[model samples]
Target chain A: MPAVVSLSNVHKSFGALQVLKGVSFDVAAGEVVAVIGASGSGKSTALRCINALETIDSGEIVVCGHKVHDPELDRRALRRDVGIVFQSYNLFPHLTVAQNIMLAPTCVKDMGKAEARRLAEEVLAKVGLAEKADNYPEQLSGGQQQRVAIARSLAMQPKLMLFDEVTSALDPQLTGEVLRVMEDLARGGMSMILVTHEMAFARKVASKVIFMHQGKVWETGPGAMLANPQTKELAEFLSNDL
Target chain B: MSLTPVHIEFIATGALWTVGLSAIAFVGGSILGFALALARISPVPFVRRCAGTYIQIVQGTPLLVTLFLFYFGLAVVGFDSLPAIVAAGLGLVIYSSAFLAEIWRGCLESVPKTQWEAAECLALTRWQRMVRVILPQAMRIATAPTVGFLVQIVKNTSLASVVGFVELAQAGKLVNNTIFEPFTVFIVVAAFYFVICYPLSAWSRSLERKLNAGRR
Candidate 1:
């Protein structure tokens, strides 16, 4: 299977400070890649670059046939092929859960209200929030809101999904539920790139794991590599978590 | 010089102009103000600067001066003999647009940055993201202030009287001159202004409470 997402030597800088020095990775169709790293290690920035949320200063990123680094790239088309959920959930506070999920489909895809609502129901059920469709984001717990955020992205039916520290804000119990939803998504053969700190979940579900250190992809392999770290940084990162 | 029912009726008719003027100014100002707010946040540096300069100038100059500028200043430039109503309406539109633009811009900014990013990730166009995701959220933040600003617009229409437009205040002054009962006539006029402004004040407060309730 061809790679659904490929990042080659991507470099990004924030004014005077360099965040992502040289990062590269690839994920094939139906592959689940978990990018694990310490804060400021550029994992999240790499994920953002894949979606063109953070423009790369140099290097190349191609996601679902869209060349993301090009200035004249069809960004909207690239975005249509990619769905991203943030740590903040970012659900529209004024909209009900169903409305929040349905917004992108109805507006971007020009899907009819009935069709969007049906899609919302299906995605909501996938995230295990089928009954909470009419509730607003503020009314839900952090886990529920994050699930709604996931379902919102799923409604777009994108070929690739990017999650940037989605459960970082939630407590342990809430994180469990969110991790379960993601596990289900992986089981369903969704192509995913998750920037996460959930080591146990990453070890269990991620088909490939990339450990980033100081703006570089220091180590990567199957999930088993996390258990037997070859590098001192990976071992140190794993130790800090425990 | 006792006040007659005919004079009361005339003043009542003037109140109608006050309401009509407020409506025109508000509707026109809201449209212009929305554009200005968009300009205020535009990615283009020149557009943002121009919008900033407009807001600063309009906000700095008193509305009374703006009214005079449009009413008398326009005539100086050879657009002479414009009706007092036209002059007053134009002045209010300009005045309201600047303030509304600022109010709306603040509301738009208050929506979290994550909302914009999430919408972008969905592959929504800029317009789609704004109209569908951002504006609906901003509108909730904007309602209290926008409605509160309406009271200011209605009260300020009284300034139109100075330019020979007979809105509520002008009508009151005219009735006061004839009856020579400054206290009673002006009191009635004040009552009319109060009648128009108080409900709007209450409505704005209620909206603020409702919107804040969700946050809590």
Candidate 2:
């Protein structure tokens, strides 16, 4: 199968500060790719670019065959096939968990309310938040809210999932809860690119590991390749990760 | 001179007119204000600038002047047959719409940007994101301030009296002139205003308190 997402020499800048500098990578169908980097390494920016959340100044980004850098790109169309989860959970606080999930399907897909509610139930169960469907986001703990956020994304049945430092805001116990859900997605053959700080989880669940430094993809190999660092930067990054 | 029964009855009629005028101003202002609020944040630069200029001009000018402009300025431009009440209502609408739009725009922007991103990523259309996700959240932050501003609109309706709309303040002036009891007549009018405004002010405060408590 063709690559699910491919980025060629992507470069982005915010005024005088360059965020992503000549970054290039690809993820095949059903492949789990983990991008590891320190803060400001452009990892999240890269993930955001794939989803058309941020316009790249120079690059060729093809996600499920949509030209991301094209000025006339259909953003909403691209987003339909890619679901992204944020560190802040970003659930609509006004809606119950079920309503939050149902909103996209009902509003975008024109799915009837009954069908949308059922889709919501299936995703909530996948995230292990079946009973919390009636609760508003603010009523949940950090971990539960993150799980609901995941379930909300899953309802879209996206071909590729993007996780932008999703577990960074959670404590250890809550982080474990979210990580398990991610590992479950990986085992079920969901294609995903996650920017994560959880090195062990990244190694175990991500089929490919990409280490980024200073806005460049410094080193990339299979998950086992992390044990044998090819670059001084990779060695330092892994050590600092501890 | 002292107040009489007939004078009190006449003032009561004026108080009723004041309530009616306030309602007209608020309902009319809110309908236009909602549109102006949306325009102030429109994606097109020209539309946003046009809204900005309209708001700035209306907000900078005094409400009394706004009333005069509608009542008299249109005549200067040759459409001279407008009634006092219509001119008065239109002026209040212009004055309140600008201020209300500014208040609402602030509330809409105050919602975390993340919420907007999340909605957009869901593949919801721009209209869907605004109606389903953003406005519900905005309405929460908007309530106290919107109501708080309503008190100002209610009090500002007195400016309509200068155009001879015969609302409470104008009624007081007419009574004072006839009875030569400025203190008693204006005091009663002030009492009418207090009665109208106190409950709304209290409600706005209670809403603000509740919002803060929820945040805590």
Candidate 3:
């Protein structure tokens, strides 16, 4: 199968600060790729570029065959196939979880409310939070809110899911539950590009591991990079965490 | 000179007009303000520029001057038959629309960029994202300030007296001229305004407290 996402020589900058320096990577269908790096290493920017949330200064990014940053590409349509979860969980605080999940499908897809509600139920169940569908985001714990965020994405039936530091905001015990949901998602053959800090979860779930440093791809290898360090940067990164 | 009961009755009626004007201003302003706020954030550069210019023009001018412009200027254009209330209403609508638009724009922009991305990820169109996600959150923060603006509208309606609308302030002026008691009649009129505006100010405070209670 073709790669679900491909980024070639992507360059990005914010004013004087160069956040990404010719970064590039690709994820195959159903593969879980983890990007790890220190703060300000551009891992988050790379994920955002795939969805065209952050515009790139130069280079080509293709997700599900649509060229990101092309301006001519049908961005609204491309976005439908690319789902993202933020570190903040970013649920609409005013909306109930069910409404949050159903909003996009009904409004953008023009689906009927009844059908959308049924789909929301199915997806919420998938995230293991079907019981909390009627509650607001503020009513849920950080982990539960993150699960609802996952369910909201699942409702879109995206071809590729980009997770940016999903568990970085949660406590350890809550972190495990969210990780489990991600693991289950991986097992179910959902292609994902995860920017994460959890070394153990990265080792277990990723088919390919990438380490970034100072706005460049520092290293790329299999999950076995956990045992066999390639660069001094990677060694120092993993050492501090473990 | 002493105040008569008729002067009190006239001032009370004028106070009622002030209330009525405030309601009209709020409803009309909100309808236009929401559009202006949306325009301020529109992806199209020209639309955003036009909206910015409109807000700047309206906010920079005094509402009293606007009332005169609408009242007298329209007469110069051969529509000399328009009622004072209609002219004043139009002017107040324009004035309040700018202020409310700025208030709502601040609230809507306050929503985090992440929420927009989350909506985009779901493939929501621009309108859907705004109506369903952004506005709902914005309205929460917007309620207190929107209500607070109503007090200003009530006070500003006093300016309408210059155009002979005969709302509360106009009524007070008519009574004060006949009664020949400046201090007594005007004080009663001021008291009436305090009565109407004070409660609204207190309610806005209470709402702000409720919204902030969770933070504490």
Candidate 4:
């Protein structure tokens, strides 16, 4: 299977602090890749680079055939094929949940209003928030708003979804609800790259897990590899992760 | 002669002109101010700097001076027979647009970067993100200040009298000149200004309260 995402020798820095140094990874189509690492290990930066949120100092990233590192990148077209959900659940406070979901479909895709409404309904139901459609963002709990954020992205029918610590703000119970929604998406075979600290979820649901340490891919293997880490950096990380 | 019906009628007409001048200033200012605010935040450095300098130059000068510049300065530079109302209206539009543009730029910038990121990731073009996402959110924060600024606009119309545009204050001066009733004639003019400004202030206050209520 062709890779849905591939990053080679990626390097990035913020001022003098180098965040991603010589990082390389590939996520095959329909693959559920979980990136786990310590804070400041460059996991989030890698994910952001994949989406072109941060320009890389050097290296190449291709997502759904869009060259993210290229200066001539059609960023809007690259974005059309990608969807990202942030930890803060950045739903438009002025819009209702249904309006939030319908926005991209109607605005970007130029879908008819009626069709956008149907798409909103479909995505809302997928995230199990159909009844909350008319409510404003502040009217919902954090988890529900995050679900709405996910539904909003899903309405665009993206080829890949990037979840950046999406459940970090929620309580464990709420995290479970969001994680379950992601699990359902995984079961439905949507390609995903998530930067997460949820070790148990990563082990249970991820087909591939990449352990990142100090801006490089330290170790990578299937979910079961967590039980037998190949390197001491990853072993120490797993011991400390719990 | 003491203040009479004809004098009251004259003042009323002046009040009407005051309102008309304010309307012209506001409508023109809002359109130009919206453009200026967009320029202030433009991605290009040169565009941003150009807008900033224009706003700075207009804001640093007094409203009276701006009125003078438009009314007298244009003729000094070789233009012919400018209308008083046009001069006053031009001055007010230029002055008000600088202020309105700054207020609106701050409101637009206050929207969180995350909201912008979310929209961009949704594949919204630069124009779509602004019109569809950013503007609606910024307009919410802008309403009370915009309405509050309307009171300033109405009050500032009195300055038009200096340009011989014959608004409320000019009419009061004419009545005062004739009746020599400084207290009574001016009191009536102040009342007229009050009548126009009070409701706008009250609406701005209530909008502020309601905006906070929504947040809560």
**TM-score for each predicted model, relative to the true structure:** 0.95, 0.95, 0.92, 0.96
Judging by lDDT, tell me the better candidate of 2 and 3: 2
Q: What is model 4's DockQ versus the real complex?
A: 0.58
Report the poorest 10 consecutive residues by lDDT, candidate 4 chain B. Answer: B207-216
lDDT of 2 by residue, B74-179 (tens): 9999997579989999998899899899999999999999999999999999899999998887887998889888888888888887788998888899999999
Residue-level lDDT tens digits of model 3 in B1-216: 467776677778778878888888888998998899999998999999999999999999988889998999888888875688888889999999999999999999998887887787778778888887788778778878887788889989989988888877778778878867777777888889889989987888787666543233
Off by over 4 Å in 4: B202-216
Query: Candidate 2 on A1-242: residue-level lDDT in tens?
Result: 57999999999999999999999999999999999988899999999999999999998999998999999999988999999999999999888899999999999899999999999999999999999988878889999999998999899899999999999999999999999999999999999999999988987899999999999999999888778889998888889878
- Candidate 1 backbone collisions, by pair: none
Candidate 1, A28-54: lDDT as tens digits? 999999999999999998998898888
Error of 1 at A190 (Å): 1.5
Off by over 4 Å in 1: B1-7, B205-216
In the range B80-109, model 1's lDDT, one tens digit per residue, is: 767999999999999999999999999999
DockQ of each: 0.62, 0.57, 0.55, 0.58
- Fnat for the candidates in order: 0.71, 0.67, 0.69, 0.65
Candidate lDDT (C-alpha), each: 0.91, 0.91, 0.88, 0.91
Model 4: per-residue Cα lDDT over A32-66, one tens digit each: 99999999999999999999999999999999999
Query: CA shift at A45, candidate 1, in angstroms?
Result: 0.7
For model 4, residues B1-216, the per-residue Cα lDDT tens digits are: 788989888888988998899899999999999999999999999999999999999999999999999999999999975899999999999999999999999999999988888899888988999998898888879988898888899989988888788999899999899889999898889988988788878887777666543254
